[model samples]
Target: MVPVDTLHDITARTFASDNYAGVHPEVLAALAAANGGHQRAYGADVYTARLQEVLQGHFGPTAVGYPVFNGTGANVLALQTMLPRWGAVICADTAHINTDENAAPERVGGIKLLTVPTADGKLTPELIDRQAHGFGDQHRAQPGVVSITQSTEVGTLYTPAEIAAITAHAHGLGLRVHVDGSRLANAAAALDLPMRAFTTDVGVDVISLGGTKNGALFGEIVVVLDPGATPGIEFQRKVDMQLASKMRFVSAQLLALFEGDLWLRSAQHANAMAARLSTGVAAIPGVRITQPTQANGVFAALPLGVADRLREQAAFFYDWNRATGEVRWMCAFDTTEQDVDEFIAAVARAI
Candidate 1:
């Protein structure tokens, strides 16, 4: 299978999302390497087996990986496995599953999502208590799980201790803990901590291990840490339509991420790029950096009409809060220092 390189314009890039970046060369190379062989279907392939082992090494021996198609699929499958028919999830109002997933969890998974407004997207035990009431109240959906995002949707990170506290609090309330780790790699990179420090060792029950946002072409996995806390995910994934029939490719991409320090290297580079972007743009007058630039995203409130003017130059960014004119700039593994410099200059000129 000769690799196809010219299928798309390689020069096309954007700061709209990490999703906009092309697959990492290493990840694509791994994908090409996994081709040309007749592997078993539906996750019965050798690559899938290898992925499980690789994930276990990072997450712990008790951890298991079930590669799925995308982040939404992983979240819905994981949250469903952690909940019952009348169960509900407690998360920050900014959670991707709550705001971005188009209600897939409620519509398809049949679980209610109880959201709490967060200043920086990180949930605490106090916030969880706000929605952690009414257990066994048949009329109200029970709060069964606390779903927290690592390097949360707003790109802020939770320290290992913060995660441990939240997990302990949730467990004491008889609710399992689920981490929507869509940017887990970024959090690990920013904190310079091992993945386990904030996950398995800290009492997290299940993880929606992300791959696409990091570097994989397209794949995410549901990693069960405390198996006793989650069951029937194997069937849950199938019922949710997240079970990839040709799962070897998905497994192969994920394996490439966890193969060596590829995940860390990519995430660190992205985070550094965001830091550089934040530093350069903050010096510009009228550009207020809103959220802490902790991970690979920089949130700022641009001067009136300045965002639109800058859009004319790059045309790829999100208005995080339209009412407040706050915008979000994302950096990816392939995002360069030159991109940051140009974007900062563009902002300065626009202002």
Candidate 2:
């Protein structure tokens, strides 16, 4: 029999996105462990129940987690449950929901996104106020939630104090807060704080707890920190087609991440690699580090034609801003020091 590694080029690596990385070994082992038993379906299994306790441990006692297939599903379901039929969400213009999820929040979830342009991807209370107004006006789509992305799309982070201010201001206005925490672990690792520091304790009503980008095969959880914040989430999950009939498998993968310290270790490693990449490229002339290396992602502006030249070396990454020649490179839990060094050398040679 041929080795599985020969079927594909396992040596190929990319800075495109963490989603490109394979599953963690522990998570794969967990999946195998959960496979033999005839567990209950649709989240009634022991694994799902244990996932709840594990999540509550990190997100606080009031937190309730619903496992979903992907980040888009989790975000849409969370938003749908948090809003009324005419509800709108306030988010940064660069948010994944606003720009990347292909408008799933609007088209599928039936929620309107009121996007604000920010210098960085982080949104402050002042930014939220721009779209949080016109209450009791039938003409306007009422803003019921202020959604922000942690370790935002531009690779910038919002401190705990900043998150508290946003949540405080939003809640004071009879609005709830939702965090698109796809990179939540990265934020926690970079800030040297637990997940709860910037979430449950800071007044964030709900969060999309990410796993795929960390080390899982595929899964994310929509965690309701405030019990009353998102009603009908159970039904909303099914309504949005995010319900997994074989949910124990999903739950088991998530448990493998949070039940131990794998989540933090993976995120910390990814963040460290990004920091190394940022430092390496900053020394190259004409390469401008666009955003602060706050998490596992690094954004930079490359000299014209240099990006195309770099791509020729098979070091794949995304062009963030075509107009500005800005690009994004994401590091995964599996990104090695050697990978970063090789990419840096390639960039130097391309220049």
Clashes of each: 0, 0
lDDT of 2 by residue, 148-266 (tens): 99989998899999999999899899999999999999999999999999999999999999999998988899999999988889988998889999999999999999999999999
lDDT measured at residue 100 in model 2 versus the true structure, 0 to 100: 90
TM-score for all models, in order of appearance = 0.97, 0.98
Task: Give the runs in model 1 whose Cα sits over 4 Å from its true position.
Answer: 1-7
Model 1 scores a TM of 0.97
List all candidate RMSDs to the true structure.
2.5, 1.5
Stretches off by above 4 angstroms in model 2 are: 1-5
| lDDT by residue for model 1 (1-351), tens | 435786575445677999988899999999999998699999999999999899889999999998999999999999998888889999999999999999999999999999999999999999999999998788899999999999899989999999999999999999999999989999999999899999999999999999999999999999999878768889888988888988999999998999799999999999999999999989988989999999999999987787788888764798899888899999999999988888888888888
Give the clashing pairs for model 2.
none
Q: What is the lDDT of residue 302 in candidate 1?
A: 85
Q: Candidate 2 — worst ten consecutive residues by lDDT sum? A: 4-13
